[model samples]
Target chain A: MHEFSLCEGIIDAITAQTCQQGFSRVRRVWLEIGALANVELDALRFAFEVVREDTIAASAELDIITLPGRAWCLNCAQTIAVGELYDPCPLCGGYQWRLTGGNEMRIKELEVE
Target chain B: MCATCGCGETEPVIHPHDHAPDHAHPHQHDHAHDTRRISLEQDILAKNAGFAASNRRLFVEQGVLALNLVSSPGSGKTALLSRTVQILRDEFPVAVIGGDQQTANDAERIIAAGAPAVQINTGKGCHLDAHGIGHALERLALPKGGVLFIENVGNLVCPADFDLGEAAKVVILSVTEGEDKPLKYPNMFAAAKLMLLNKTDLLPHVEFDVDRCLDYARRVNRELDILQLSARTGEGMEPWLEWLRRGRHDALIQQINQLEADLAAARSRLIHGGGAIRRTVI
Candidate 1:
């Protein structure tokens, strides 16, 4: 799965931060994953655990925050909240929807020493 | 123990008594370390995105129209790329960065077709990330106004998530595959802007429903541009070639437009500052 590669990216980012922030051990990580980011939470957790082995975050706890998906409905002329990319507009039942939000995966904070 | 060389025969260093807590907790622990909270607020994919941005900048600087070609394992990507290179190599300089799990066969094929090519054998990587492509760019001498085709590892899933700094992701689907490939792999179809339905020459011999396939692809990406072609028989190659020409033309136009805007801004600044302002060509 791509989760392993994504976790590699996360670890690289964290390692880079450790150099600039002067931290040796990371105890916890808080991540914000959007609904439409196309990442499976369990898969990410598994990947993170495997990737963090023997690193600064070996015993770190992962905290995940999910964001909702938002899209623009062309027919309804309004912004609508969607749960998936292929969903139709809830207000007008139209498929002419454009994605607007909830397509992000970011690390928000870290507890380190 | 000495910090320099831990021989375990030195006096142990201890913290001052004042630094110790007054009382131990109900569930006491030996390690009493103070943790610090740091606010990062950074995208996890920032590293990849940074590489991608740099690749895009390099492409613009070189006026190279880069395209990432993706498809299943046997979707005729190499053939189409070879054919495209053979036909257009005389007109414009072209290069290729072929990705695969092993072997340099595709790169060799592209080279034989009369184009500069390099093979990136990803040991275990399913898709070509931006960082890999950036390294490949270092090895390739892509001329200005040339085309760089990056043939990704034959995967329709993982490549959908990675940004390779291409002008567009072109998915090539052959007639031998299922017509509902777009529906099955929606992410790939959704990410691609163009779908080349290759192997049209075999349409009569095979039971591939062209209309149904297009319908399924359109269902996922309504704005996708579809081109039917057969790299084997040179049928319907004009549209595909035209598409490449247009991409290069559009990139040139964009560069000209940016230079003109930069010039205008520089002129205004010079007019206001009595010729002391420096010109910025971004």
Candidate 2:
């Protein structure tokens, strides 16, 4: 699954930060994943458990902050909440909207010792 | 105990009464082990994005029309590429980079069809990232002013997340599959710019609704271009080929515009007598 790949990236980023910050271990990791990012939360947690072994984040707790999907509806001229990429504007039932938020996968903060 | 050097000393002696209240300890002591929170706010895919940006720069400099073809297993992506290569090779330079988990059969097929091809065997990776594509580009010469088709690993989910710096992503769907595939895999459909309804020759044999499939695809991505074609029977291939030709023409125009801009900048530098004469070799 792509969640595994994303986990690898997470570990890599953590390892690099460890080197720069001179931290021996990561106690917790906080991530910001968007609703429209196409990532399954359960799968990501499972992948993180499998990928964190013997690394700096071996005993780290993963904290995922899910961001809601938001888009600018061209027809309604307002920002609307969307659940998926193919979702239509709820107000106008139009497909002419541009995604303004969500679809992001970022490492926000870390608890290190 | 000193875990760092393994000195086997179980404890360290600290004399707090010998030091003043304002004195700082020079060695380890029994103090609170504080855990610090570091705010990073970094993108997880930043490394891959960097590589993809470089690949995009290389393609634009060479005027290559790179298309990433993604689909599910047994979607006849290789067959379509073989046919497309055979037809397009006569007009301009064409190359392919095929990604599979185990075999090089797709690359061999494209080579046999009269175009250079390279096969990337991603043993455990579900999709080809931009880093792998950069390494593959080093092994194969870019087809300037032509087409470089990157046949991504036959996966509908993972490939939608990785961008290989292609001009467009073309998803191939054969009629043998379900018509509701677009709705089932909305992310892949939404990411793709075009969808090729391949294996049309089997449409009559299979109970596939072409209109229904198109409608579903539109519901997912309203701007996605669709084409019905069969690589085996050579039906509806002309329109697909024409689309590729148009893309190549646009890439060539972009290259010309970039060159003209660079020339104008150099001419202005010369007119202003800025620094020594520097000749740019293209």
Which candidate should be chosen as best, given DockQ against the real structure?
Answer: 2
**Best candidate, lDDT:** 2
Deviating ranges (above 4 Å) for candidate 2: B1-32, B264-282
Cα RMSD over interface residues, candidate 2: 6.8
Backbone steric clashes in candidate 2, count = 0
Write the residue-wise lDDT of candidate 1 on B36-114 in tens digits. 7999899888877887887887787667889999999999999999999998998888999999999999999999999
Candidates' DockQ values?
0.42, 0.52
Worst 10 residues of 2 chain B by lDDT: B7-16
Write out fnat for all predictions, comma-separated.
0.61, 0.71
- Candidate 2: residue B63 Cα off by (Å): 0.8
Instruction: For residues A1-82, write the lDDT of model 1, one tens digit per residue.
Output: 7888888877777787764565668999999998878687899999999988877789999999998999888888899998
TM-score of chain A of each: 0.94, 0.96
Candidate 2 lDDT, A1-113, residue by residue in tens: 88988988888788877545656679999999998887899999999999998788999999999999999888899999998776778998888888888888999999987
Note the Cα lDDT for every prediction shown: 0.85, 0.87
